[model samples]
Target: MNFRKVRHVVRREYLESVRKRSFLLGLVATPLMMGAMIFLPFVSEGLVSQEEMRVSILDRTGRYGAALIADASPDLILTLAPPGMAEEELDARVAAEVLTGWILIPEDFAETGECTYRSGSITNLAVLESLRTRLGLSLAGAKAQELGLPSEDVESLLRPAEMRTVRVGHAGAREGDFTQVYLRAVMLVMTMFFALIPTGQILMRSVIEEKSNRVIEVLLSSVTPLELMVGKIIGLGAVGLTLLGAWASVGVLLSLRLGTSLPISGGEIGMFVLYFLPGYFFFAALLGSIGSICSAERDAQPFLMPISLTLILPVMMGMAIAQAPDHWVARAFSFFPPLTPSLMLFRYAIKEPPAWEILATWTTLVLATIAMFGVSARVFRVGILMTGKRPTLPEIARWARER
Candidate 1:
């Protein structure tokens, strides 16, 4: 292999990609899009109308109606229904938008605790939850009064305890914020997906275009297929790293300006890099091989789908893995080479796994990446100049096995 030729190829690939308008736009747009996705819900919540919910109570037992009206919050306009008012009347009131909902407390309330809430639309979870909570507290107080407990003691007994969580770690103890940990894990996984998949596709498309244009023939005059492949991977991988670095810098600046600490630690960031590089190389080599065999983008999709699914499945299961980092399924998947990057990152975010497990997964991923690169190089060497029909699986396997 001529190192000089490889260097030239790497320089050319890097310069060509970084100079594109799309790449320039992506550097600014990607972070803004991710920021909007993260914070938009909170902004939307603030925009929600603070209209008071008008509700009526049809208390058949005649015991809890006055209590509900008294305990209702400022946002709730609660009123007792007229004596002997039919269920149809309440439904009509809801349909007319005269009431947000109507609560039915049955006559045998002392024996059966079931109640029904009827509304035209049941999608307002906040209002539903508030009503359920207040109703439950009111029922508990009524039962306490029946048991001859003092009113003041009932209030004290029904009050919820305030609790705080402290997470003890190697660095010492700090207040635990599950939301921060969850968001950090999601961000890390998304970062890997954005950095790896698109860059890999770019590599694949570059290879296909070069092959289709017979440009590889000219390049081969100076560099071996292995050199060309390695150079392209390194150059594009550098592009991905540049993107990650830019995002990380922006995140650090924002966190500093906002007087907030980063949710991720230095060690976790190091692990992320370790997993990220091999994961990129593995997929890049796979995509590069697929690109080598095909003449067009359409021809590549059949091969690309499985690889795409492998990356996506881990993300879909991310919540489960984070919730139970030490579960057998998560632990087992952490050792699987294709899933190691995302699943292991999730586990690390929730709870750092054993050192040997991390080392084992990392080693496995590195070995898989090297093996994949070697196979891809052989396939590329054979298929780069082939131009007629797309090769079969067996033919591709034969290419990899050949000298």
Candidate 2:
């Protein structure tokens, strides 16, 4: 409970972490890596050239083949294969890189509306969809001509309607899209991982190293285990903040350069900061406890693996959140203690959650953080001094409940 001792511990831990060459490199390199990863695809789009794809068509109908040949664009070239050419030969050509791919228009394509496409390499869905649309138009035109209707009339009948998405909430209607949801999910998950990992590693590594060196026995002579654990968590948490700041600054610069807006608004950014701190503390303490109860990093693996997977669960649900942000599953994850921060950040960006939900999520996180640290400190006190073997789960539980 000595404030002076806690401050000294904090100062030493922070200074040692910041002074490392790895830390200095991360301060510069991580941000640049983050920025490049986010923006480089967009920037490189104009610079990279795509070779036009040539797809051979086998027409059993013979009606739509000529229409497809005439409508071919600069990026897509459609050629009619010889009447007797085997599909096996065509597939071999595709495999040898002589052809990009091939499409087969069935005799019953107009009736069943199904056709087959084959490729040795990856198929481009955009190109395939384009080909389908063109074929559909051609069949419709042929049918219209037989009924003495003009091609323009058929085209008009087949035209697609436009629909724009708007999300309505207390703030009123706003333009919304799935892309924004995905971008926000990626940003939230990456930022959380980047900031949380180093701090957690520091907690674990410091605990393991100190135990191995028998330094905790010497340190506990001066300060209580609770104070030492708190000091380490705070010190390492500050170090993570530094990394987050550097990475965020560089990301902003890159976004500006790419003429791209960040997915989250100012308020969402504030909420991210709010949620991330407690989330980090919860995980850091859990990892610190694992470090304390184990003889080495290898000894921590069986325990650490579950925690790692739990943290990854929110990230794995990102695509589902992007598709249906307010679904019951997403809502459930948003309220879950371990996943609250990351999942809630995603929901906030997709569409603002109810205010009560936000409050509830934060309340759960705060309580979880406090309880986690309490348990962690208790385990650390006993396990930090025990070096011969890793503590059993029951023993660790006893330590937490010990007066």
Candidate 3:
């Protein structure tokens, strides 16, 4: 193998990919989309209409109506029901949109402790919850008064307890909430998954295009097929790494600016690289071989679908894996090469596994990746020159077995 020729091929492939307009646009757009996904909900919440809702309370007992009105928020326009107003009349008023809702307290002396709420739309959960809370608080205060206890003591008893989460680690305890940690872990896995698929498809399409245009013929004259293949993989792998580096830098800057930090340690980043490199090469080799076999993008879909589905399987089961990182099923998946990268990273994000398990999983993945590359090379060498209808499974197998 000529190292000089391989270097030339690597440089050519890398420069060609990074210069494309699509690549440049994607470099900027991906992070913006991710940021939107993260922050848009909060922004939308703030933008929700703050219009006040009108509500009428009919207190047949007349004892709790004043307390309910006093406790209501400014956003709620609470009023006493008109004396002797019929229920049917109130329903007509609600249907006419004069009142957002009306509450009725039974005439019985608080024996059943039940109330009825009627509204044209019960879908406004915030208003419904607020009404329930205030009504419950008023009833509790009345009960406390009857027992000769203070209303403040009853109010304090009704307040929910606040709890803080602290994660204890070898480095010491730090405040880490589940949502932040989960998002960071999911982002890491998503970055890897998204990066690999596009780059692998690019590799496949590049090979098919070059073959169709007879560019591969020109290149093979200067370098062996093996050299060309290895060079392309390394070059495109570099492209993926470049993308990841840029995104990581952006993430760091955002974290600093927003005063929100990801709980990712340097060791986690190292593990990501270890899994990512082999995972990319494995998929790249597979896609490259498939590209060498087919003459068109449409011809490649049947071959690509299974691989794409396999890649997505772990992501579909991500929630389950996160919830039970140490489960036997998750542990088993971490050793399966196709799932190892994403699943292991997900599990590690939830809770770091023991050293021996990590070592074993990495070893299994690397060896499988090596074997896949070896087979893909054999198929690539034979199929790169073949043209016509796509070959069958047996034909591809025969190509791999040829000496």
Which prediction has the highest TM-score against the true structure?
1
Quote model 1's TM-score. 0.92
lDDT of 1 by residue, 1-403 (tens): 7888889888988899999997888789887887686567757755542677889999998988898899777777999998599999899999999998999999887677889999877877778888888878888889999999999999999997889877565555667777667777777777777788878998999999999888999989878999999999999999999989998998899899999987678767988898999999999998998899999989998777777777656667867876777899888888778888877887777778888999999999999889998899999999898997998889999999998
Q: Name the lDDT value of residue 179 in candidate 1.
A: 65
lDDT of 2 by residue, 287-340 (tens): 888898888888876766676666657667767766677899888777778888
Per-prediction backbone clash count: 0, 0, 0
lDDT comparing candidate 2 with the true structure? 0.81
In model 1, the runs with Cα more than 4 Å from the true position are 38-52, 168-174
- Sorted on TM-score, best first, the list reads 1, 2, 3
Candidate 2 residues lying further than 4 Å off, grouped into runs, are 28-51, 82-92, 121-123, 164-176, 256-259
**Candidate numbers, best lDDT first, in rank order:** 1, 3, 2
Assess every candidate by TM-score.
0.92, 0.88, 0.84
On TM-score, who's better, 1 or 2?
A: 1
